[model samples]
Target chain A: MLQYSEKVLELFTNPKNVGTMDGDDPHVGTGVIGSPECGDVMQLQILVDDQGVIQDAKFKTFGCGSAIASSSLATEWLKGKTLDEAMAIQNVHLAEELELPPVKKHCSVLAEDAIKAAIEDFQKKLEGRTDKAELHSPRCCEKLNDCEGCGSHGE
Target chain B: MKLPIYMDYNATTPVDPRVFEAMKPWFCEDFGNAASRSHVFGWKAETAVAESRETIANLLGASPQEIVFTSGATESDNLAIKGICEMYAPDGGHIITCMTEHKAVLDTCKYLETKGYEVTYLKPDTEGRVSAQQVADEIREDTVLVTLMLANNETGAVHPIAEIGKVVREYRARLHSHLFFHTDATQGISKIPFNVNEMAVDLLSFSSHKMYGPKGIGALYVRRRDPRVRLAIQTHGGGHERNMRSGTLNTPSIVGFAKACELAAAEMENNVAKLRHLRDHLEQGILQNVDYVKRNGHKTERLCNTANLSFGYIEGESLMLKLRDIAVSSGSACTSASLEPSFVLRAMDVPDILAHSSLRFSLGCYNDLAEIDYVVEKVATAVRELRELSPLYDMALRDNTTGDTDWAQAD
Candidate 1:
């Protein structure tokens, strides 16, 4: 078994705020990151108020134990924080807090990217932008997958 | 019973008390090299080794002379594949095997490939059985060996080795004549019914640890008559094991292996029935209670002690963590120190999501109905909990949560 921290195991077994929070609600900013191939797919949604403060955060992650723990921690950190404060939550910080091994650090990166993408989606609605907001850049190898003749891959 | 029950019997089984008792003498008072001909210790050790060899041979319906002891199934596999390839390399360098074989066989074939040998890895059907026709189609004049697994470790899909054996037998008599057949029956030997003559496998491999015997001991069945299959020796020392393999024999483990095989031969019928009862009950309960669950492998042809299931929308790693009371395996390669989904399930064309969601729960002689009940209840609960946390499952339940999101446009 992977050496998951106790907190990671606890949050995974009893993840907080797992269900969706009215995706149609204008105050909701939903961010879906990750892919099936990468073995992680996270959809994080935030409930923000007029003060630009996150009132509540909920998520659903389809991945391994660490991925679920990472997204769960992201949601827990998102609630009650100002948008700027939430933005400051880096993947590295999450990795350190979760004590995730280097191989699993990408799960934390997905969590952080989900935060940015969700915030951008909410701001896009606020600006009345009709075009869909671009989400996270696919991590490393998944990015170069579309290019031919370049077999070099990221870890 | 221990709180966290061991359900991963396919991985390795605990040594039976009888086997342990049989081995204790060899490890202590009877400790002597079988090759020592001058003393009573050597005679006693050789007697024990001969008896154990007879026991293993009896279980597989082969002669005692045909059984050559090795460290374990991995060594048996390496010895069989490489030995056969080396023996016939001057005449033929082509071998045929399947993709789902244990790494021992696959990696050995790969090493042979580096030495200018050709190998054909046949793909199994959805149920994980490589057909006899597939093997027959690949066999050629240069095909010196055909190595296939008798039972898959992950799915427990029992290949029709008898059918494949028939094909090889026909080819050996009518065509190539020198083409030999070997099977890594590491998962099959005592767990399922097997006879070397019926399977027509010239050489066969099996491990002791997988059959309630001690680890670090196994055997390779070599044909002695009817064309008399041959292999080049991999380990050259002491000129033991009929010049096929050379090393000081593991007397204790061999004795233990024989004891385990004797017990299995005596009790296999009843144990298999009990295991089947518990396995079927668990499979039915989990399937009836859980949602989007699919069973891998053949419905009836699988081993009675094995059950491989894919619980959709639930990550197998998370499920294993939550179902802590029942030890089992997941498709997550993290457990195996990798990140790839199970290649066995991938070969079956199970979707990536379900493949990652797969779990292998292998029942054993020690397991009872109560433990099966524990697994059925705990697994259903765990799957429900993980699916609740799963976004795809949640979105699947809620009709249009993703109506506006464009997945392809993310790039």
Candidate 2:
């Protein structure tokens, strides 16, 4: 019943780089954001180099087709781009590229938020603020295996 | 089978060719108002109307005079609820209805609440069942009407309407109050056969489109013998429909509706058997192959055609998109285009995340084993694809494998 552009359908049907990277690697910073209740959950990972340029980007989302397409497009746009250029990528560009209706615009926003959160995680890793992992638990903020933040309640 | 095999029969059904054939003459050669009782054209039309009325009445196990046509289930529901309230609650009284009723019944009861009527909205169980005991507990001396749905549109869970009706009858006798029982049987009319007499029901409402009939026609069965129900006429035109409703008959649609009922009366058992088989095959296939899947209603007491499943960690809208070739609906597909989780599931206490991921596949008479197999394959593929991209699914897997993801210490 939704009017999906060919590009959106293409990316969603065959989304690229849709898996988790080395969450423990300092070069690989992962950002997980979005609410599962809203039908938008995006986890974007990026491998950054000393030059602050993204070498690779990957994403996995549990949301609508537009959200999957949006994050997939975000990953495609993230690689080889500097942090500043990646940050410059607005939700409007994603929405326009996907030809999404107004109702689906939030999906692009979630992608943008995932990008910002990943960049923040990458920067935090570079600065060696590992203690801040406490802020995000039950999710891979820093550690992928044993989550100290979620240590008490059995997940 | 055609692509996008329709599985939302609970929404609406295709008009059967037989029903269409029966209606075609009414639209052309037989185009005469039943109210025009002065000529041959009128007599012919009146005869056709009478024959159709008998057919519908026979299907409902009622008399021809008991059947009253309306625009659709919505109008029938409105007339029943408001008319009963007007006749019995002139000075004001209490009404009872459940939370998971179709909007036609719920909204009408809600409007009564605004007009100085005390309404008690009963909550169904987690399996989406409104128990007769719940209705009995809510009954009081002032309770004038009890309106509940026979089957939930979203969950397809069949409530014990007969028992609930008996409860209302008992309370009415005890209190000597004018408490009447009404049920919206739009989803369960022919799908699961029941007679108003055995149920002790005063009013029953159902739609034509839901049973392979035309879209704009429906009927309400009003009891005429035991206690005899009366309504304050909402329309006052030509005093048609025994002065209960006033409007020119929609001859074509009415004939179509009756033909559908006749066909259903003959073949419903076979269709239901086939539907149950197909539905169970689909449900079992998905549950066996997929993980974190939960059925959304009572297993045995549901419409044989419906299967509502919640796939954990998968967004419903996204799942529906991947299933474009299969005509199914997400739980929240009805209202608000923003993809909110189904309120029906929420009322049943389903977690919001699971509710967001739920899909409702309502099978119909036309669907066959081949279509069910195709649906199972496509749905399995779609769910697998979406879950592969779901970080929640990945995280849950990791947590389970590690036997650790306990974030309770943070609290």
Tens digits of per-residue lDDT for model 2, B119-190: 998998989998999999999888889999889888899999889988888888889989999999999987
| Reference contacts preserved by each model | 0.53, 0.63
Relative to the true structure, how large is the alpha-carbon lDDT of every model?
A: 0.83, 0.84
After superposition, candidate 1 runs with Cα above 4 Å error: A131-155, B399-411
User: Which parts of model 2 are misplaced by more than 4 Å?
Assistant: A131-155, B332-338, B401-411
Candidate 1 per-residue lDDT, tens place, B1-411, comes to 569899999999999999898889888799999999999999999999998899899999999999999999899999888888888775448999998888899889988898889999899888888889999999997888999998899999988999998999899888855788999999887778889998888999999999999999999999999768788889998989998889988899999999999998999899889989988888888877786777888878888888888876667787888887788998764444456678888887776666777899898889988888888889988888887888777656665544332111100
Best candidate per TM-score, number? 1
Cα error of candidate 2 at position A81, Å: 1.2
* Error in Å for residue B391 of model 1: 0.9
Give model 1's docking category: acceptable
Q: Interface RMSD for each candidate model?
A: 4.8, 10.8
